[model samples]
Target: MDAIVLLRDGLAAALTPGNLLWAFCGVLLGTAVGVLPGMGSAMAVALLLPVTFQMDPTSAFILFAGVYYGGMFGGATTSILLNTPGQASSIATTYEGHRMALGGRAPQALGTAVIGSFVASIIGTLVVALFAPTMVDFALKFGPGEYFALTVFSFVAVAAVVSGSVLRGVASLLIGLAIGLVGIDGQSGAPRFDFGSPVLLDGIDIVIVTVGLLALGEVLHVAARGRNAPDLASIRAGKPWLKRRDVRRSLPAWLRGTALGTAFGPIPGSGAEIPTFLSLGAERRLAKRREQRGGGESEFGKGAIEGVAGPEAANNGSAAGSLVPLLGLGLPTSATAAIMLAAFQQYGLQPGPVLFERNGDLVWTLLASLLIGSVLLLVINLPFAPLWARLLKLPKPYLYAGITLFSVLAVYAINASVVHLVMLIGVALLAFVMRHFGVPVAPALIGVVLGPIAESELRRALAASAGDLSILVDSGISLTLYALVLIAAFIPLVSRVRRLRAERRERETTGAGTS
Candidate 1:
């Protein structure tokens, strides 16, 4: 009953005239950012962080939540229409969504993505409302050693699961760890990687690294590749309209995707990518099984509606899922969530065990606002699909130039330091190299955000135990987390070995037949 009253109060706060206007503006801005290639909610939220300093924390957070949901929806628009995902989460959407566009069923693809996202978003929001406090309670039981173990689990899971090559992901994460080593040492007040430079003592700002790597790096890479005309002319249909068949196929897939997303959301190091890919793989297998049984034909590769529907739903669902850790444990699983963490720090807020007790109104109001934002996204996205497609019509040179310009400007505006500008360019170059070599970028961002936390916890645990390393593995939670890390790490290697063996057998069989 008390929970019900708090929820009602939160809803009332979110629906106020001023708050509603902020939600609308945030949705608009976030959608626009999502429609642009390589621009993401992280950048949007980071940019707004300095700007929203004077506003009420609740209102600023409401705006950020709106942007977060809007960006998820908007990225789907670009994926369906142009075969180009505006954000990493939308990558799976492009596999079949673009094919649907090419087949003159762009409207159908768009409809599935939007509707699936809406359903998943609502379900995810309800999850946050019901489980956040419980999660906070659970988090309070963790010690420094448990926290250290959790970070290891996160590192292994994220690196092994996210990248196509585990070695590359580990390499990227190392780079981030190395970056994290810069600045003054937490315990000794000694600088490790500053190289005698004053600017290095403060450490590289995460905002600079994020914008440089994601936003600027993408632009530089694109410019280097030279522009090609995006083939969006034939895909432009009116508003997204769902057919009966489309509804029949997408409904179950939506539910399955939502389940996968919700399950993975709070796990450290697991983000939207894993859930989206898993949903797509599941849907593909289901379609194949249906074909074998003669119940339906499988469209596994050539414009399957279920492919678009399931992954898009998972993407949005995971977005909501990431919040579970962010709000409940002060752990961020993805790049955008990392930026949100920074925002929390900026507002003098910490998002952990005491957040609910200390800031109940803010926390509940934020949850209510997320629910409100999801509805607003549905209303706003449906009508704007066509207009967003028009964004692709803009000249490539001007668009990329503008993105690069704004990225540099934003970094400079943050600290007014020439050193940051220099660091931004350097990081952009490093990101370009990583992109060229097919390195997954998220683990790097994750490492940068989580590395220091892990370091701090490790040191604390050692100090508490008189430098005994055994304490790091003493607790049940720590042991379980380490065991899970071993499982997460071993599964990928085992799967890879099995796949290679299977492929070798198939090749031998084919060679024998040819001979």
Candidate 2:
């Protein structure tokens, strides 16, 4: 009842004409930047931080909330249509989303992604509003050991589920780990693979890696295919609306993804990447089960609607989930949240238990603004999804040329360093070779993302326990995560063995009948 009263007051405050206009501007600006590779919500907020200094706190927060949600929505647009992810969180969507676009289901993919993001954003914000304190308590329980276990779980789940072959997946993951190890060691302050260059000491940026591997690599790969390359412009986009059948298929996936995102979002350092990939793995497994029962065909390797829906939902939900810790504990789980934290400090407001007591109205108003932002995002983006898909209709030469230009600009924009451009070319070549050999690039990307986190957490746990191995599993959270890892790894092996046995039995029966 108290919550209801506070929300009512918040809505009354947030629905003002000035606040509504700010929300619209924020979402509009956010979507524009998010559609560009390497430019995400964090950059958008960072750029606008100074402009907000003159604005009221409530209006400023409302604008930031709009940008945060809008970025999530825009990231999916490119990942589905162009095979380029606007940010790391959208990478999971690219695995199946691009394939769906190639199969001429671009409109459906975009539709599912938009609806799923909207659903997740609304639910995730409400979850934050109603359960922020409880979620903060839960997040505080994680130690280094638990964090290590969580990374391991993510590794095994993505490797086993995303790859067609386990060996290839492991190889790609190792390549990523090696790339992640290029900079100076954080613990020892010693260079590992700097190659005698000052630029190498700082390590390769994630933006460079993502753009090189997904965007530039794709351009090179297509160029290598010569005239025989598939013509994307020829692919006919069907109706611009999601059919009832598509919605029915996507609704369950959206809910499951939202649940996963909400559950993992509050954990510091977990980020949207883990939950988005986990959601993809879960949907893949469920599709396989449904196919085995003769209920439906699994379209995982092709472009399944569930794949786009689940991961996109998870990405937005995790974005919303990260706010729980940010508001209640004053902890930033992501880059954008970190900037927002600075914004809070600039306003002389400290977030914690006292925050709710001291500025209860402001907190509720912020949450209400998030809800309003979500509605604006859907209204602004849904009508134009089909128009976004029409981007593929451009001539291949122009399309590829545009991609190359953006790829170069994205890398050069990092620090205006020529060495990064050289590294981008190198990474693109590596990606091209991997693609030629049918090696999955997703695992490598995951490794680059989670490898350092895993290593840091493992070392922290060991250092804390004075080199005691038992300390890693001493906590219930760590133990449970390891158990989940075992189950995830074991299930695939069991299925492979059962299938081999069935094949052998069938062969022997055929031989006996022939005799």
Candidate 3:
């Protein structure tokens, strides 16, 4: 009865002409932003944060959420058509998407990407609706140590070694940790690397960090490659249609990916990023084995519908999984969720255990809105993909210059501080340098966002225990967790050395052949 009430209320709220318009406008703008190279959903959301100021909070958040959903959908447009993933989530799509485009089946590929993403998103939203109650119950029981353990578990569970090599992946995680350590210390509240800059006192904003590292850093890297005035010829899909074989092959893969992706969703930091990669790797290996047995690796690389299906499901599943901490404990796992967290805070609403009691309608309504958005995305995106794909062809200078202008202006608008604009530029430069060194920027952003909370929690845990060291090891759960962290933190180094050895062997063979 309560759920029904909330659904009715939420539907009423979401379906209001004003809210519906915002949702539609959000999706359209988000899709266009995401389809453009260097203009990811994160950057788009960050850039537009200022625009939401004049809007009602409820309508604003609905729009933001719509933008997030639309951005993910739009990411595949460029990845398939141009071998360029609009964002990180679409990287795996590029492996198969570009191939499908090359085969003169661009329409079919776009259809699979959109349809698969839509179905996966719907399933994921349903999973959230059905499972959130149980997850909240489970998460409410977590102590600080348990939460810490969950974070470690997230990093370990999502390791690429499970899909590719474990060591290299672990290294990427450590890089994130190191980046998280920049700025002020959470517990002591002292600046770490402020370098005498007053703007560093408040610590790095997650939005700035992500925008700086992914967008600004990418721009610098691309500029370094001297591809300054690149021209694009749009790819076309004539009569896009999925064949019976495509359907048969993709359904199983979609189901498999959803199951696999959902299972890995709740381990703290684990999300679609790793799960998609792992799913793709699994599909590739399975396809190879099947080929060796005379089935032939038909769709594995050439936009095999399965390739599109698995990663899409994994990404959506991960998004649903990410809500676990946000609702259960007020922890935001992904950058998008972090931005949502800020939105929640703006309305003086805190998300956590009490959220259900205080704003059950809002919470349920939010969940219901997710389902609505998923359906809307599938309906809109599937038919207009070629149009979406052309969004990638927008002039880079105009787009990037506009982004640069907006990022600074947004930062200033938020605080009305000249210092913030300076801070944004500084981060942009730091992010660019960080990328030149091959460092993964996501962890750093996660670190900056999570660092303060983790520190605060650690201190609270100690104060509650009256500073006894035993508190850290008091529970079997904590001991087990620490041991797991130790294992995860070291695995990447070991994996890297192993990979180097394999490469060396191949190199030696080539050198000997030349001799």
Candidate 4:
């Protein structure tokens, strides 16, 4: 009942004309960025962060929520129409989605993707609203040791599980940690990496780092690709309208994908990509089983509406699900969520249990705004998906130039500092190098956001226990988190070993045949 009352109040606040306008603008901008290859919600939000510095926090968050959900909706458009996934999470959608488009069922594939995204977003946001408080209640029990353990788990999971190469992921994370260490030591007010520069003492601003790494770095990387960039000249998106039979086939898949996404979303390091792939695999298996049972013919390789529906739903659901941890535990599970965390810090707000107590209305209002964003996403994206795809029609050089302009302006906007601009260039160069080396940047961003927090908690824990190392695992909660960390770290190595062995066996079999 209390939750209901709060939601109602939030609805009232979110319904304000100003907030609604921001939501509309955010979704529009988010969809545009998502339609463009290599640009995601994280980059959009990071670029916009400086613009929102003076705006009301509530309104800024509403805009961000809209952009976050809108990116999910827009990613499927390119995947279905062009076989090019705008975001990593949309990679699963491309398998059946492009095939569907090739089979002249592009409209049905797109329709299912949009509607499935809608269904998943609505259900997923509701789950967050209902369960976020409970998560906060659970988080209230966390001491410094437990928090440190949680950070450790996040670090290992992101560095080990998210990256294809664990070594590269760890390297990226160390780079971020090193960047985070540039400021003064919070514990003793001692400078660590200032190098006798006044600007260095203030530390690298999150805004500069995000804009440089995401927006500017992406531009540089894309520019380096030059003529090799993915061509969008052959893109075609017809009207996306589903037949009754298509709807019937997609509904169940939508539900199933939503369930999987919601289940895995809150787990740190498990991004939308995991749930989306799982949904794809599940849909593939279900179709096979249905065929075997004489229920229907399986469309495993061909364009299946179920395939597009399930993965798209899972993508959006997981996107929404990531918010649960971000809102309740102050943990960011995805790149966008990590940037959102930086936004929270910019507003002098922390997104944990204390947030609900101190700014309960803002929290509820943000949740309500997310609901509004989801609905707006459906309304705007359903009919305009093709138009969004045409965003690729814009010349690449011009698009990159604009991004470069914004990157510089966004950094310059931060207290109008030239030193920050230099730092942005350095970070952008670093980001390009990381991208060139195939290192995952998300883990690095996560390390930048969480490294200081983890250090502070660990230091506090040690201080409390008089430098005893065992204090880090004294509590059941802390021990459980560390245990999960070990499991998370170990699983990747095991998988790698299996993969290598399978490759070796394949080589031997191929050699025998050749001989």
Candidate 5:
């Protein structure tokens, strides 16, 4: 009954003309950035953070909610049409989306992706609304040791699972930790890595680093690569239409993907990308099994509609799921969620159990806005698919030039400091180097965001136990978190071995055929 009242009030608040206008604009901006390669909702929110500092928190979050939904909607647009994933989560979609495009099923592919995202987003939002309170209760039980263990689990899971190589991921994480350490220590009065500069004493601003690494770094990298944009001239950009057969195949896949994605969302360090891959893998295996049983024709690689629907749903579902921890525990599990956490802090608000009690209106309003934005995204994205495709044809130099300029202005606007510009350049350069070396950047961003919390919690837990290290493992929650971390860390290794064995078997079979 309380949930129902809140939802009613939330709908009333969110439906105001001013808030609705903000939601529309946010989704529009999010879609624009989402259609562009290497730009995600994270960059959009980061750039808007400094600008929205003085704005009302509820309205600002409404704008952000629109952007979040729009990014998911528009990401699939580029993946299907240009074969270039606009964001990391869209990578799985590109595997089959582009092939479907190449096979002249672009309309069907686009239909599946957009509709699938809508279904998943709805399911995910409902899950959040229903389960967030429960998670808050769970979070209220966490001790310092448990929180510390959770952070460790996040660090290890991201490092081991996201990157192509665990070593590179750890290297990126260490870089973030180093960045996180530069500010003044909260427990002590002393600065750690200020290097005798007053400006450094405040530590690196999250806004500056976020904009520098994601926004500025992308601009510089694109410019450095020179004139090789993919051709979208041959791509179709029409409205997506689904036949009965297509719907039949897509519905089940969409549900399955939503389940997998939503389940992974609350787990620290596991993001949308993982669920999409898992969804795709499951769909592939299922399709193969169907074919083996002589049940029906399987389109495993050649424009499979299941491929487009399932992974896209998973991607959007996980995107929604990431909010669970952010709202309930004040923990961010993805780059976009991390930026949103920063936004919460910027507004002098902390998201957790207390947020619900003290700021119930804001929480419910934001949730209501997510649902509104999801609808807006579906409405806007469907008819605007052709327009979004045209976005890819915009001159790269101009597009990136605008991004570069905005990034500079946003960074300088934060503190109006020349030092920030310098820091932006330095961080952009570091990001470029990391990208060049195939290093994963998400873990670095996560580390920077979570590092301080982990450090403080570890210290507090140790202090409570008189500096005894065993206090780290005292809680049942901490032990479970640690165990999960080990499992997450080794899953990749086990998968790699299984893959190698499968390849060996394939080779043996091929050899026998030759004989």
Candidate 6:
């Protein structure tokens, strides 16, 4: 009931002429940013932070949200047409979407993607709206042990699952932890890694690390690899409307994607891209069973409709799912989510516990706006998806140059520090090295961002308990959390051993039968 009242009031505010205009403009700008490759919402938002200083916080936030969602929406275009995901999240879409384009069904492919995303976004928004407050209460009671356990769990799950390799993920996380350690020690009042620089005493800024690793690193990586081809064209289908059967086949897939996304959305350290792939894999397994039973043949690699539908649904739903932790526990799992958390901080807003009581209006308003945005995406995109794609056709020199300039300006504006600019360049070089070694970047990032906070909690808990480690065992919840972490850490190796044993047995059985 309280949520309902809040929602009603929020809807009224968001729908006002001024706010609506802001929303539209945000969506447009966000879409444009999305059309450009490697230009993620975090980069877009970070770059715009300077201009935002003078703007109303509400309107600026609305624009940021629009850019965030719009970038996501635009990412699919390149994936569907060119098999190049504009951002990381659209990677799965390209698997089947590119095939659809080759088959001259680009229009349908685009339609399904847009529609699926819109639906999922709405579901995600609702999940945020309904569960955030309750979850915050649950998170607030957590002690240091629990926090540490959760942090470890996040590192393992995201690193092992999100990154290509568990070893590399752990390595990257450790690096982040090291970087995180480079500030004044909260407990001893002594600098650990400042190296006598006064600027280092306060610790590295999250904004600095985020922009350096994500934006500037991306630019440097592309530049180092030789100039990217200019004037690449995207799929230019005539329309973006789906066929009748698309709706029938996709509805089920969307539901499945939504389920997967919602289940994983609340978990920390997860990103939007993984859910899409997971959904695609789930659909394939299910589709294989249906084909086997019904005498249907596989159409998986050939633009199977289910491939498009399931991933699309999961991606959108997970986007919605992501809001759960952000709004509830104040944990920003993805890079984009992290930036959003930063935005909240800039406004002096904390996401957990009292957010509902203090900023219920803003929360509800955002939620209501999400519902509207989803609908608008459906209507706007189904017809205009190509116009969005045409952005890729623009001259390459201008595009890349613009992106580079924006990257520089955005970073410079954040601090106006030449030292930070050099730092950004150095990080970009490191990112390039990591890429070459196939090390996942996100874990390193998650580590750097979460390390300090996790350390703080651990130290606080230890001090509170007079350095007695037994307090880690005091709470049932904390004990359970640690247990889960232990299991997660070892589960992969256990599974692999079991799998290899089973395979060996199968081979032995086949040989015996031949004899």
Candidate 5 minimal-lDDT segment of 10 residues: 228-237
Q: Compose the digit string of candidate 4's lDDT tens values, residues 1-515.
A: 68778888998999999999999999889887786555668778998999999999999999998888888877777677655556667767877887877666666677788889889988988887787766445545677888788777767766764466889979988988888898899999999899999889989987677666666777788779888855544445567778788888999999999998876677665578667766776787688679879998998678888889998999988887888888788998788999999999999999987888898898899888888888888898778756654555577777567657755775787689888889988998998998898986766766777788789988999999999999888889888878877887787687679879999999999999999
RMSD of 1: 5.3
Clashes of 1: 0
- Candidate-wise lDDT, in order: 0.80, 0.88, 0.66, 0.80, 0.80, 0.71
Candidate 1, residue 213: Cα displacement in angstroms equals 2.1
How would you encode candidate 1's per-residue C-alpha lDDT over 149-191 as one tens digit per residue?
8778767766775576889989998988888888999899988
Give lDDT tens digits, candidate 2, residues 50-127.
Answer: 989988888898999889988887888888887878877888998899899999888888888888988999999888
**Residue pairs that clash (backbone atoms under 3 angstroms), model 1:** none
Cα error of candidate 2 at position 404, Å = 2.1
Query: Model 5, range 367-466, lDDT digits (tens) per residue?
Result: 8888788888888777655565555456666656766776677678767999989998999999888878889676676687679879988999989999
TM-score of each: 0.74, 0.96, 0.68, 0.67, 0.69, 0.69
Q: Pick the winner on lDDT between candidates 1 and 2.
A: 2
Candidate 2 structure lDDT: 0.88
Q: In angstroms, how far off is 417's CA in candidate 1?
A: 2.2
Clashing pairs in 4: none
Best by lDDT: 2
Error of 4 at 198 (Å): 1.0
- Candidate number that wins on lDDT, 2 or 3: 2
Number of colliding residue pairs in each model: 0, 0, 4, 0, 0, 1
- TM-score of model 2 (CA atoms): 0.96
